[model samples]
Target: MRRRPPSREELDDYIRTRLALIGIDLSVLPEDDPDAPADQLRVLRSARRVLEQTVPALSDYSLDPQEVPPSMYPAHLPAVRQVAMEEGRPAPAAGGSGRPEEDAP
Candidate 1:
């Protein structure tokens, strides 16, 4: 199913909410304040424009939440290596897979 693109108001609301999540609340600034986040807003607007132009091409696809992989947490590295050693598989190199790059399929 195809979804409608977000309205300008919706995008602005999303951007503001994202900023607030990071502790920057644009709403508290006086409307006339010269230091208000114009540059950040401009960049977000540009990004939104790019998305509006590009995303329609992807609307034919459906995304399943279960198909998305979970993110790896950096803190689990040591434990991951220990588990690999326990299982008799060689531990992965510091920043590479266990296999050499040339050997990877």
Candidate 2:
């Protein structure tokens, strides 16, 4: 029997579902935690990379969640979302001008 490949949409849905399990909240942490942003970004990047790299190798036999070996799921999604949220917010200027640096500099 031949195996079918998992569709891109399926992969994306799986990723999102797994990510949701970890509680994707971004507003609670301090912005200056030097390691948080990078760690989250790494996880998000890894998830994307894994999907891109592994999806091509998957056959119909591999498409089934039960048959497919379990990999780390969304261990980093929350972290990534948190960091991204923080980064998205406007940080106060270094001089405390109440304006963002883009305006000052």
Candidate 3:
């Protein structure tokens, strides 16, 4: 026999319980009123769907913990490197030298 996935209500209850654990109370949200538009719940459910699709895809990548992308550069890194070199010490180990603006004055 195959195991069944959780129902929508079950998942929602799980989310509510988890949120409550973190001090978030979903009960604070206004109840669905027949007189008003259903926009709030619709948007919340849409965001949940987006997360469901996004989280798994994001988890697929095996990223290095020490790896830093080339786009992120610390402004003070060059100064640090210069100080290290002046003191007769080796430059610090970092991803891609972490110095995007080394050539820039």
Candidate 1 residue pairs in backbone clash: none
User: Clashing residue pairs in candidate 3, if any?
Assistant: none
Candidate 3 C-alpha lDDT tens digits along 1-105: 233545566656666677779997656556664455543355357556645556545533333333543356545555776787798766543333232232332
What is the alpha-carbon lDDT for the whole of candidate 1? 0.56
lDDT of 2 by residue, 1-105 (tens): 233656766765666678678976423444345567544434544576687666534421222222343564533434554565588843323221222334221
Off by over 4 Å in 1: 27-41, 50-105
Better of 1 and 2 by TM-score: 1
Q: For model 2, what is the error of residue 36's alpha carbon versus the real structure, in angstroms, after optimal superposition?
A: 4.8
Task: State how far residue 14 of model 2 sits from its true place (Å).
Answer: 6.5
Best to worst by lDDT, what's the order? 1, 3, 2
TM-score of candidate 3 to 2 decimals? 0.41
lDDT of each candidate versus the true structure: 0.56, 0.47, 0.53
- lDDT: worst 10-residue window of model 1: 96-105
